[model samples]
Target chain A: MSSFVERRLSSPVKVAWLVALTWVGCVYALGLVHQPDVAGDASGGFWALVIALWVVATLSVAGLAGLKLRSKPGRLAVDLLTPFLFGAFLFFLWEVIVVGFGVPPALMPPPSAIWERILVSTDLLWADFRQTFLKGVLAGYAIGCLSGFAVAILADRVPFLRRGLLPVGNFVAALPIIGIAPIMVMWFGFDWQSKAAVVVVMTFFPMLVNVVAGLEEASRMERDLMRSYAAGYWETLIKLRLPAALPFVFNALKINSTLALIGAIVAEFFGTPIVGMGFRISAEAARLGLDMVWAVIAMAAVAGSAFYGLVALVERAATFWHPSIRK
Target chain B: MSTTSIPLVGAARPGLLGKLWRGNVGPVLVVVAAIMVVWYVAAVAMNWQGVSERFARMGQDASAGAVFWQTMAEDRPMLPVPHQILVELHKTVLDVAPTSRRSLVYHATETISATLVGFLMGSALGVLLAVGIVHLRTLQKSLMPWVISSQTVPILAIAPIIVVVLGSIGLRGLIPKAIISAYLCFFPVTIGMVKGLEAPDRMQRDLMRTYSASTAEIFWKLRLPASLPYLFASLKVAIAISLVGAIVAELPTGAQAGLGARLLAGSYYGQTIQIWSALVVAAACAALLVVAVGLLEKAVMKAMGGRP
Candidate 1:
């Protein structure tokens, strides 16, 4: 027994396994004990066990990370598994603590209950996605980004306008642009149109500013080389400047993708035609449907991530020559 | 291509008018005037329908010129003209007593307080998390991805839930809004700080290590100072986003005290001018806040012997 203990302590991986086992054992022991009815009334043993689990888990994770797996596949697996395991363990702990304490689902639904809510509410989630993401956010993002780019081109051509407008534009962008949601609803009436307008307003200036900055990205030497070839303004702009500007343009796009979604969602809160993520979130919360709200939140999280990922994918392909993308 | 085309350096070489013409202020003024003209025209075109209907209701004959002026001065124009918004802003921000609930200044103060609190909390949390992640290899691998994922969820979708849930827990008004603002603000600061903290090159880090410096010593002497520029930049972004968060928080709660509430009230009553004024005030507040951060950056950088 003394030799086995020494062997385990001598190896990082063995030490990690020992710590993880102890954590699980403590959790199992805690599971056997009667938990308090309320989180506020948690006993000293419960608190002590929770603190011990945190320390044990932390040590295990740190030890695992410190192991230095030699094989490429092994390192990759460890890299991927760390976050996945951490996230899963966090959810498991949350579910256990909430359920064990008999906490009200209305206040904080356990992960299992939220999962069930998500499973049952597929139709509602799809409808909300259609109303918010498809109709409002997509349309607005396209319109806003295109117009902003077009204006940026025009502003680049006209230095006077560029000098004049950039300051005002930045100021306008900095405002609580979400505040326009209510007024847009009043103007466009309680529908996706209003939401789209809010998104357009929210996304426009960021795109404009980034694109304008991007147009100036080509250094003096690069421009001088283009001029040496006697390339016209449009020719120089298309071949040299725009390519250099692609990275900056993509930055704006990524930002606008998230902003457009957020703007559309928030616009729905004021007044809307029944089906939308923002409307459902606000309405369900009022009714204390915490599980349903979490379900919608999950939908939003997935959609937003997908949207951002799509932009990033396009950016990587388009800006492959850029230093950030170059392998 | 032609660096010489860049304007000459400013010195004691020009008259006031010449200087004004060459300066940013003049071009900005010209653009502002041009926008005002276009806005006035748009206001007349948009408000004419409602104003003319009122005129019809009163059985009065009105010329186009009279109608245009009337639209510009309407109590609640469909699209508030620039002058109408200016007048409304004056009344709400200056003419009305500061203590009055109707005053924009009072609403602005409420919003600003919430924004400041949220910004401070978010920045502190972000720096703390960034420091831990940088020091802990496990946390960097585990938490960083989740941190990125957390931002993908629309804040609007969660703001209402957070407000409702926290409200149930008896955390009301300022705290909920601050949390939401912090939620929005922390991401940029974390990403920026992580990059900032890692900014010192391998040589510099090795130098510190060769000196037998402790982890805290290296972080304080090398990493923290190197991170200042990035930290300040992200802080400016965080502060602006926090202000937006505070306003959005107010919106979902139907609160009656902040700039968001003022916007909601204006929308409820179809008070276009009121909404415009509130928006202007919010914009001015944002500009000032950003400028304040920029000034602080300058001061700190100067103190640290960095170029401002």
Candidate 2:
């Protein structure tokens, strides 16, 4: 029996099966606590039993994650399953603790309530998505990035300007740029335009700094080669330097994707139309409608992630030849 | 990087002027001067309409030059001239008593206190989390993905929620703002520290093992020291964002003490100059915090026998 147990420990498949069984046990224990009669008033002994089961399940998952699976598919499966199980367990704990203890929805709504709120408020969420993400974030991101790119090229040709601008750009990037949101609101009026303007300022400097750094990425040998071919500045830029700068440019893009969302949302807090996510959040929060506030936050999270993921996907496609992406 | 070393082609002579030209001071000054000029011009142009309207209401046919002069001195200009903002800063920051609610110093202190508290807590938590993740395979596998994805979420969007919820629970004032600041900053620290803690190579670890150096000794002597540079780099970033987080947190509270509150009050009253002054103070706070971290990094690095 000891030899059989040692063999089971050494085999990845067996360890995974053991982990699965422990998780099942945890779920069953959770079910016991989640019952209508037991919830919010479970006995101390019962709580201890459920918690002990959870601890075992967590340890089992960890053990499974720690196993050295040699096969590529097996490794990939474990890689994917570990985080999934961890996240699922977290949600499970959140649900059980909040519901079982009868925590007030005002203070902390369970995930189930948040999900239900999302399901019921699709129209409001979509409108906010359109207002903030589609209008403010996209428009401002495009303008800011393009202008920064143009100015970076101009600065590259003028060595003095580059020297003057790089430090300033870095300084501006570090500032609490969202402070300008109120000024933008005053200038553009309380609408998406102000939010877009704030995003434009917030995004421009990072893009400029990155593009300037990117422009310098082409090595001396590469530039000399272009010179030997009599390739003009624009030609070298388009064919060689710009391509080399793809990674840095994408870095700026990825950073700005998040910044743009943040700028737009925060700008709305200064003032915005009633339809935007920030407005909903600040308004609902003030009125103590935390579920709705969380619902909006959930929407913002999904939107922000989707925006960042989209940029990253584009980056991968554009800079496939870059070492980082190739790896 | 090459751009910093580039001397002015025509001004490469041996003199104070040439030395200044070669260094960043001259160029940065020139750039700042240019910005001021542009700002003044934009200020005049933007405030032109309002000034003209005022003149028209007074039934005075003011000349273009007169109108231009008036633009620079409007009570609530569309864009306050640099001098006007400077004057406002002078009044609010230096003229008023530091303890007064009306003083920029008081507001800055309020914001900075929250920022520093949050930064300290967040960075400590982050380093601890990083140490755990590096030492525990289970943690590295289970938590790293969530850490990265958490950043993708615009965590700042939930600042108001956190502030309000925490307030409802009677955890008000600086604590809630600090919590928001902590949330904003911890991500960078965690990412940086994780990379830092894992920086020691296999050879280094093997050497430690050969010496019979325990895990604690390896961490304290090798891992911690190596992680210092990365820690400081992220600390610089973390401090700046922590200030931002604190400022944003102050917004929802509408509490009249912090820089963010000043900004909100200014916007509500159409006090353009007040807003500009508050923004400048906030910017100064961010700059000082970041520079402080940088100086601390340099000192620590030097003491550790590393070349700063």
Candidate 3:
């Protein structure tokens, strides 16, 4: 047994086995929490066992982190698995504690209950997703990004406007731009359009500021080279400045992706047509349908992550030659 | 690329007016003026139909100029002009007693209190997490991904739920709002601090090792000081979003008291001017918080012997 322990502790793959055993131990502890007597009784043994499992799980995760992986794939696997295991451990703890204590679902619904609610509410969730994410977030993101890009170009052409706009843009970006949601809802009525308008306003300044900074990224020498080549304004912009500006533009895109989702969802809190992630969250919470609220929040998390990931992927493709992407 | 066509104003005039025109202030003022003009036009256009309907209801055959004037003066205009909002702000923020619910200053105070509480707590938590991550390889590997991805999760969608849940548990008033604010602000600080803590290069670490310095000593003397600039940058972001979180938290509570409550109440009653005034106050609060952080950053950086 001592030799087996020593062998497992010495290598990355063997350490992964230790991690797997600890994970099993955590699952077994969760099972113990699910036992009938544990729910009703505040037992000392159950608490002790749970704490012990937690310690073991934590140590194994730390051990996994300390592993010296020699292969690229092994390193990548560990990189991905560490966070995944940590998140799993947290969810497991949440489930165990909630179930063990028989805590009120209203205060904190367990993840299992949230998953069940999500499973049962697909159609409603889909409709809200369509209304908020598709109509509001996408439309607003595209319009806001394109207009910001155009204005940045125009501002580049006119230095006077650039000088004036940069400060204003920075100032506006720092302000609580979401405060305009009520006004947008008032103007555009309580539909996805109002949400879209809110998103547009929320996203525009960030894009403008980033793109403006980006447009100036090309060095003096590069600009001079373009000038010596007798490049026209459009030619220089396309060949020199725009490429240089790609990273900042993508940074703005990533920022705006999250902003657009948030603006749309929050705008729905003002008023909406019986559908939207925000509307559902607020409406359900009022009714104390905590499970459904958690369901909506879970869906939102997935959608937001997917949207941001999509943007990052596109950014990677578009700016592949950039130093950051290359790294 | 040719510069000969335009004469240099500084060389020609060398006056204050010329300096203002050539400097940042002139263009900014012009832009602001232009925005105001556009806003006035938009206000008139948007309010036209409502004004005309009211005129017709009152059996008055008003001229175009009269209708335009009425548009600017409507009580609940579709879009309130700048002066109407300014008047509302003056009435609510200046005229009313600071303690009154009708006072914008009262609501602003509520929001700012929550923002400051949350900002302090969130930044402390962020610095703590950053320190742990920097010291513990396990924490760096495990928590970093989640920290980065947390910002993408639209965590504010759960703000209402948090407020409701905490309120149900008797954690009412400011604490629930502060938690949301802290949640919103902490991510930036953590990300910034992690970067800042790792900023000490291999050479610096080696030199510290050569001195036989303890980890705690190195952290306090080297990492903490080096991380100030990043911490301040993130603090600026955190403070702004902290204000946002406070306002949003106030929203789901349904017009109790706060700038967000003012906004919700105004929206419910079609009080466009009220909403605009509340928005202005909130914006001012955000600007003040961020500027305060920036000034603190400058002072601390200066005290640290950083370049002015």
Best by TM-score: 3
| lDDT per residue as tens, model 1, B40-68 | 88888988998888887898777677777
Q: Candidate 1 DockQ score?
A: 0.60
> Which parts of model 2 are misplaced by more than 4 Å?
A1-10, A26-34, B1-12
Cα error, residue A241 of model 1, in Å, equals 1.5
Task: Give the alpha carbon lDDT tens digit for every residue of B164-233 in model 3.
Answer: 9998988988888899999999999999999999899999988999999998999998999988989999
TM-score of 3: 0.96
Winner on DockQ between 1 and 3 is 3
TM-score of chain A of each: 0.86, 0.93, 0.95
Distance from true position, residue B279, model 1, in Å?
Answer: 1.2
lDDT of 1 by residue, A112-203 (tens): 78999888889989999999999999999999999999998998887778878888787777777888887789889998999999998888
Itemize residue pairs with steric clashes in candidate 3. none
RMSD of each: 3.9, 2.8, 2.6
The segments of candidate 3 whose C-alpha lies over 4 angstroms from its true place after superposition are A1-10, A40-42, B1-13
Give stretches of model 1 more than 4 Å off. A1-56, A70-73, B1-15
Score chain B of candidate 1 by TM-score: 0.93
Query: Going through the candidates in order, what is the number of backbone clashes in each?
Result: 0, 0, 0
Best-matching candidate per DockQ = 3
DockQ, candidate 2, comes to 0.63
Q: Candidates' TM-scores?
A: 0.91, 0.95, 0.96
Better of 1 and 3 by TM-score: 3
